[model samples]
Target: MRNICAIIVVFFMACSIPGYAQPRHSFALGDSVFLLDNRPFQMICGEMHYARIPREAWRQRMKMAKAMGLNTIGTYVFWNIQEPEKGKFDFSGNNDIAAFVRTAQEESLWVVLRPSPYVCAEWEFGGYPYWLQNENGLVVRSKEQKYLNEYKQYLMALGKQLAPLQVNHGGNILMIQVENEYGSYGDNREYLEINRKIFQKAGFDGLLFTADQANDVARGFLPGSLPALNGIDNPQRIRQLVRRYNNGKGPYYVAEWYPAWFDWWGSPHHVVPPEKYTAQLDSMLSAGISVNMYMFHGGTTRGFMNGANYNDKSPYEPQISSYDYDAPLDEAGNATPKFMAFRSVIQKHLPPGQTLPDVPAAKPAISIDDIQFRETTGIFNILSSPKINQRLLTFEDLHQAYGFVLYRTKLNGGAKGKLAVMGLRDYALVFINGRRAGILDRRLGDSSINVEMPQGSVTLDILVENLGRINFGPYLLNNKKGITQKVLFNNQELENWQMFSLPLDDINAIKRSAAAKKYTEAPVLRRGNFNLVKTGDSYLDMSRWGKGVVWVNGYNLGRYWNVGPQQTIYVPGEWLKPGNNEIVVLELIKPQQAILRGIEKPSLSN
Candidate 1:
């Protein structure tokens, strides 16, 4: 009897060896029969990029997904933020991918990891590190050997942390996407296959899938092996995808179901009605098809990572610092009415006896006002300091990644005809002797403009604003700040440009003093004050101001322009202080003062 008991115990141990003991299940594309664990398991997911949401808030967001009856959480691991420099990887702080996946596991949630080197999520440079732009003759997201090799290295390093978590390895990671929506770019089967090989070599032997809009599935979807998920608003499109990829087999998914949208610098704040979202979500849930909310939580862009878009005709447009996405969860992690409504819909569809945990309390909002600030150093002092390179340097050359770059040059022999910038990325403000003369914007693609030259050691100031990095299309690979080529006067290249790297990563680095007086070509430190007893949410109107950035009580509010669209800047209540808050404005165009007023709602029509 003792020998029989021992045998039984050994058998139980062998059966319970985590994911290893699980049966080898085959997931294949078929007519209405995509299988998970050899069963037709539908994927109900909520999309949230790990890099976009704060690491501390990962669990909360996952909990929100669970509460919405989502069994899967789809996320994109951004390459740029994970590896800012080539060969140098950072998985710590907000860049922690393993921690994020582990948190999802704790919630018993399956994951769809989209580690796109090109995830056009309105992020800075479409999630491609600005350092990649520094590579000579680099053509990103292409068949180029150098680009593919570097991408492979990034994948290899990323796989080290992610491969262990895939479902084949017994973790909750369900499927890994190859590249983002490739159909939108071009039909490059060779490039797609290369990406697939990279993942396979990385030890990710799990199910693979591709996500694209309905029209793009034919071009974007990998043929014959991996199933394709549609990113669409209509439910009927699922049948179309099933016909194309899996001969009528179901378990279809809406990889990116948009519940909200993103806002840009000059455009007014956007808000999607809860009723419309409810209807769309209801249809997907009723159809028994799995869906993922594009962004259940859209966090802040923070620094200079906000990306933009420029059609061949339209002006170069950049996004705002706030990536709120008008999502169910706001930037501060508070649940909106839409969250409550969606939770109700999800509870209706949950399995028997499955109840969502209690909702988390909203973070307290603070109101700060009457803050005071003083500017110390002017543009001239910075220009006089020294030069990093002999020739006029772009933002990329100084190793300064983003934001505005100020280039100054003295008028030689008092000869200045048509001052022209070879390749202005976005916007440029030209000043002569501390006065604004003219402005160049990328919308017009104006290479050179006529400028007047004053006599006797005149100072010339050219302030360049990184409008926004292109987040999609072939243009995505071409991301750099400042002048790409050279500045010229009368067809002659100008030399000796004093470059000031103002990639303002830190707001506390701003110098303030009353005694320091320095000259600048267009030096204007516009100041204002407001009173607040207790800080509440407010939008600071920055519409009247010319091109420049703003700071509230020393916190950089982000770049603003007089251009239409995003005129009012979002000032989070958490960033504010109670009573006597100070505000400072730095306008590149001197002599123009700006007035700021607080509004309850975000400014929509600048």
Candidate 2:
């Protein structure tokens, strides 16, 4: 065994050279620990998603992680952010993960890539591109041939960009994870095995691993790899769970230790005391077990990127725009009490003579002058040609994701009867003859909404908003938004509906819609301008507004509902230009007396 280790070290030594891809780096799975270059290695890692932060700010965040006494960086590669369209891949700007890894390497930090094609990080559709639904009979997170084919295609394309970055090839990547938390989802050894094969085939070879909660550990791990656990407390229990699957050896690992939790719209802000998880973090280190902070820094979920949730027991619950997670580092990357507490714990656990860097300077944030919308636009006026279908279709069927869809039909006989739509994907406003009759909110879990038919050939319009797609659990596979089935009035199915795809991918349609002469209702796009002699980080207070999306200088900040949990949309200083800037809000409900202001802090629970 010693000779084998020596030979492996010699081989890697021969390969480690400046700028050489896959230079001789040796990282292997020992009885229960990770062996790097024949030595027991400990990983104090921090998890953050590159897609959630701005491209320009990646380095700053990494530096922040380092200052917090972290040796490694962990991140999930979001599939939807890269492959917004089918067969088309993006690897530039904020989606440039290879660049993100290389930048981490510059900071002398190793990386653990959670390349789960199904990463359920409170993201839309668990990071699966919405276009995947367009494939007929395609089942995700399974061994289905078509699904695997697409998965392989995406992995191969991703590999072409990231394969060379493995530590063995001279990069800093320590391990690449398979599908995330599979045990909690199901028992599919075959599926995980396929995942392992494809990852190795794609050149992500260093060490492959699986991570799961305690309840699902039995099936989350595969043979020939390290098994890791995720939880908030009970460090000893975390070690025990990993050992249960790894032959009771040393070098126990916890992949995700939650210091805070995520929040959904309309719910109270989720928070935790600094000692709640930090104490457990200290315990894990003291016990000689390595752990990764699930979210050292939780950033924003800008645009229509936020996901939704629904099940047999619960209504459709959409995540708030901010991915803040109430973590050690706030949404704006400011270190909170949790950050200071963790740093103190880590300081005591550091190897002799190893010192953590000082915390970085905080950016200044301020309130800007209030802005108002002088011009108005109607959604109906500026839309692409409608797709004529006998029945209503899903967003994927219409090649749309993360926006609104309008389904319009005419009541020929001016019928006066009870109207009910079955299985509304999310929220919708029922309209009769251009006036809102009632609203259908999936959050209430009530698929049926009453609608009164008026006299004289009334036109019926149902505008549905795709709050977000579910990111986890049994409902993950079928999270297509918009109307799933048909509408019914008096037990009679309605037909001949013209559906308009309001994807809101770009504001061009909204800009053109400004020509609309008569705009006097909700779902109206209000425009305003604000001037700033100087610019810094700030949050746009949406307290006076109803539920809808917001845009600044044509950039979608994200969805802001009047719900108490999240009342502000984070606007970074870099996104602002000195002088004048534009602000647009799509108030879907009662367009309040538009009183918008910029504040220094987020009123999450207010």
Candidate 3:
């Protein structure tokens, strides 16, 4: 046994040397533990989404994970961003899962791929393609043939890029997870079985596993495959549960050991002190229970990629743009004190003479004060071609996926009462004759507002914003944006609508005029410019601004709301240039000042 251990360490060390040919090793499930190259292997992993991190920072993030004493990297494949449009696939840039895995290999790390068709990682539509909702009678994450067929097609397409990288194919991927946390959604064993088969068909010929909370072991586990626990720490109970499913043998694994939790828009930023989890981690390590930290480093969710949560208990809680997850690493990829605590605990459990790598040096950060907005534009000024209809059409109905939509109609005179929007999916700004009337937010359960119509015909426009799609619980399938149904004036149904799909795919295309000296609640785009001597990571403080999205050099920096919790947007230095850089903000509400500032550190609070 000692000889085998020495050989494994030497082999890995050799693989780390430059110009060395990376050798593939076997990863198999033992009676009670994982076997790598016929030796017991304890998998220490960290979850980090490649899409959430900038492509330029992938290597640096991986190095940070390695320095934190992680041997494995876990990631989920988001279907929405991978295939934004039906049949149109993008595997390059940040969507490059293959490159991400290969980079993990370059760092001498193995990977656990969770290629989820429905990953409830607080991602938009739970990582599902928006086009799926357009299919009639297609129930997602189910046995519906339409959904299944689409699922299979997408998996196969993704397989072409990633399946060949599995461990069995001499790649670094050690295990591939089945559908993510299915027990929380359903108890259909057949649905899981179908998913397992689809993974195999997609060319993942490596060890397979299913992860669910402790109580969901029976409901979520795939028979004849490795069963892993999520959010569980009790060693005795973990062993008992795994043995019962493994025919009285062992290999206890906690797939998601959360050190900290994620935050939503209106809530306080979540933080778990290092003291709270260091002991649990030590206990698990001493018991040889392989563990994967849920998020070793939670990066930012750029663009309209951030998702929302909905259920009977909670109102619509949209996730903040900064995924920051409050994990061991901060949002900008800087190691936190929690990282040090975890590293110390992990180092204590390492084999004799084996040392964790030195922590990477902190990246430089820059701050700019008062970036001036010299130009402006409004939603009304930048209208697109509209689709005319008697009734309203949804974002999907017009083949749109994200951003804002404008619904315009002429209101006949002498009509005055409560303006009710039936099935307003998220939020809308009501306008009467080019003036702000009121606002309706689904988060507040607001469906209508009292309005008095003018004596003559007046233009009525409702600009609806897709806050984010429901990313978890039973509401995953109920994801359609921008007014899913009818709008009413008093109890009378309103008609003759012209719908403008504002996907906001390209912010740079929008023409801008001179900046407004004053402000209004109407949706307006403000442009600012700042010069830099050298580019480094920084946070754009949007605390003074109202609810809206910002773009740096045309790269959508994500959304910001004055709502408590997240106050600054993480601006990756790679997005900035040494000379002049442009910043654009689409403010939905008025602000006290038109000025913005860049801070060196993230202020994820109100």
Residue 159 accuracy (lDDT) in model 3: 87
- Encode model 2's per-residue lDDT on 1-606: one tens digit a residue: 999999999878756543344456788767655788888788889999898888777888888888888899899998887888988889988889999998888788899998879988888898999988888889998999989998998899889878788888878888889879999888989999999999988878778889888788898888767888877357667667777777776568788988888899888999899976766788878877778888888898888888876678877789998988888888988888888899899899888898999998887898987786687776666667899988888888888877899998987655566777787888898877766777888887666655666667877888998888898889887777788988988889999989988888777455544634333454677788999888888998888878888888877889888866898899987788888998888888865457689999887877
Model 3: per-residue Cα lDDT over 8-73, one tens digit each: 999999777532455667999888778999999999899999999988999999999889899998
Winner by lDDT: 3
Off by over 4 Å in 3: 1-22, 513-520
Local error of candidate 2 at residue 505 (angstroms): 0.7
Per-residue CA lDDT of model 1 for 207-263, tens digit only, reads 777777778877887764455555576678776675667655555767788888988
Q: Whole-model lDDT for model 3 versus the true structure?
A: 0.87
> Top TM-score: which candidate number?
3
Deviation of model 3 at 444, angstroms: 0.9
**TM-score, prediction 2:** 0.94
- Models sorted by TM-score, best on top: 3, 2, 1
What C-alpha root-mean-square deviation, in Å, does candidate 1 show against the real structure?
5.6
Residue 416 C-alpha lDDT in model 2: 64
Task: Select the stronger candidate by TM-score from 1 and 3.
Answer: 3
| Model 2 CA deviation exceeding 4 Å by range | 1-24, 513-520
- Where is the poorest 10-residue window by lDDT in model 1? 367-376
